[model samples]
Target: MSEVKKIATRDSYGNALVELGKEHDDVVVLDADLAAATKTGTFKKAFPERHIDCGIAECDMMGIAAGIATTGRVPFASSFAMFAAGRAFEQVRNSIGYPHLNVKIGATHAGISVGEDGATHQCNEDIALMRTIPGMVVINPSDDVEAKAAVKAAYEHNGPVYLRFGRLAAPVINDRPDYKFELGKGVILREGKDLTIIATGLMVSEALEAAETLAAGGIEAKVINIHTIKPLDEELVVTAARETGKVVTVEEHSVIGGLGSAVCDALCAKAPVPVLKIGVQDVFGESGPAVKLLEKYGLTAAGICKSVKEWY
Candidate 1:
């Protein structure tokens, strides 16, 4: 069997920015002294004149991005998820989100996959923060292809968008010809009637693997990849819930207010099925290898399968 290709979504974000820059003259990129880490340095190298380094001040960078958007220029403010979504919460909520500017927040190193960076840098709560800001479009792409497509889609959409990218390289799973990238739609990767596995970000690939494991045990599992989390494809989620009669939400974020919470919120109002949320259990991450952290936190495919079997 051929080895699966892997690429970090952060790299995809940078490469996509370079492509967007070439196509649109008004597409500008701003970084809070994390050009290399956030991969916006690639855009800087390609378009030196258009890329702005706003020092280490994440809040100031948000304000600058907001100002740049006023001139009809699309600015993608790049930074670590901790500073971009946590530290700059006020600016993002007021300046960009309140006025509804055409600014994109490329928040790289999201979730515990940030590895040795520890809890301070690992932003497991960014999705919840961004989702609270009314009108903010939250998207957490699963792999390279989805991340690149999300960048272009965010550029096309005329509003505030918060994009979460991972530090660890994930397998390229959506490279098939039938793949499509809609801004607010979920993709059904595998069809089954026993139960539904709704996942986002890196968990999408893991969900597929867990589905295979479940199938081996004669427990068919439907897998849905929700790349866009804000205007969550609630319709797809609801329909899948109604069909499968049970749901399991998986993500790399905290279970408090992330994908799991969003899924519960939708299901409660519409479907109201039994749910098992698999993610960070509302605790801070510690310094460790990225892969080990995932294993310890029960975010891997084997962990997911174990959880599903116990819950079911």
Candidate 2:
């Protein structure tokens, strides 16, 4: 069997920016002294005149991005998720989100996959923070193809967008020809009638693996990948919930206000069903290998299968 290709979503973000820059002269990139980490440095290398390094001040970078948007220039402010979403919350909520500007926030190194960077750098709450800002489009791409497509989509959209990327290199699962990237659509990867596994970001791939494991045990599992978390493809989620009857949400973020919470919110209002949220259990992450952390937090495919079997 051929080995599966893997590429970090952060790398995809940078490569996509370079392509967008070549196509559109109005596209500019700003970084809070984290171009290398956020992979915006690739854009910097390609378009030195367009890339702006705003030092370590994430808040100031947000304001600058907002100002640039007023001039009809689409600016992607790049930084770590911790500073971009957490530290610059006020600026992002007021400057960019309030006015509803065409500014994209490229937040890389999100979730516990940040590895040895520990809890301070691992931003498991960024999705929740971005989701709270009214009119902010929150997107967490699953793999390389999806992440690149999301960057172009965010540029085309005419409002504040928060694009979440990860430090971990994820498996490329959406390389098939049938795959499509819609701004607010969910893709059903596998069809089954027993239960539904709705996942976002890196967990989407893991959900597919868990589905395979469950299938081996004669338990059919439907898997849905939700790339756009803000609009949340509620129709798909509701339809899947009604069909499968049971729902399990998986994500690399905290269970408090991330994908799991969003799924529950939708299901509660529309299709109420038994739900099992698999993610960070509302605790801070510690310094460790990314794989070990995921294993410990029960974010792996085995962990997911174990949780499902125990609950189901």
Candidate 3:
């Protein structure tokens, strides 16, 4: 059979919002002037009344979303990652995060994946921003299937959530129709011993490839695909760390405040190991193709292999 078919998390969010709208009348969508770009246009078209386009006012939209949630309504505020996390930090923190409102924040165009939109739109620091906030459930689904599952799980769970997705297409690693998600749980795509590759979001597929390459090169790598960022599956990570002596973390976001940092923090207190983080270093992205940007920032499978060769 062929390897898994790649699809972006944006496509999954678009479809899942429509599906959620069908079941819950109180499920509303609030987009901060980027419905089409964020792929929330489908929800607006399907449920016009429930969809609120809060044009260009990200900070304000977050407060309004919190208000809606306080009224026992589920509001999924959609926008680009930079605006949602960086631009609207205070509103999201005081209104939603502190109060612990049941609001679902969908931040699209995350990481260097926005490509041609350049560094201005990329939200590589969002993971660090959102993950730092208290009472916030941060998650980055790997592909379409996982994104769909995440949306459903977020809707059912009663609390504040930040679901980040990329602008580019990523391979679909999951195909389970009846998949049930328990927050803070991760999946081991392949088991190994020599080293461990801990990855999330778009990097999961690349990590899988890196692991395969490592095995072929006589280096067994245990691959842990962590779909959820906050409330992270520390148990799985600890187990993996203990199993393997060397470790590497990969993500599309920045090395400081993204998946790698979270993994490192968890692994340090619980189970420390030699960790090499594979992500964008202290630099902003330029306007280029998504794949080109990823390659330039040392985020490809080949990059992972090189890091392992040097670090481990």
lDDT of 3 by residue, 1-312 (tens): 876577778888989999999999999999988898888999999999999999999999999999999889999999999999999999999999999999999999999979999989988899899888898999899889889889989999899999998889998777766555667798888899998898999999999998899889999999988888898898988888888877889998889988888888888999988889889897888899999988888889998898888887
Tens digits of per-residue lDDT for model 1, 127-149 = 99998999999999999999999
For each candidate, give its TM-score against the true structure: 0.99, 0.99, 0.97
Checking candidate 2 for backbone clashes, the offending pairs are: none
Residue 150 lDDT in candidate 2: 99
Q: What do the candidate models score in CA lDDT, each in turn? A: 0.96, 0.96, 0.90
Global local distance difference test of model 2: 0.96
127-238 in candidate 2: lDDT tens per residue? 9999999999999999999999999999999999999999999999999888789999999999999999999999999999999999999899999999999989999999
- For residue 54, give model 2's deviation from the true position in Å: 0.3
Residue 297, candidate 1: alpha-carbon lDDT: 97
Candidate 1 yields a Cα-based lDDT of 0.96
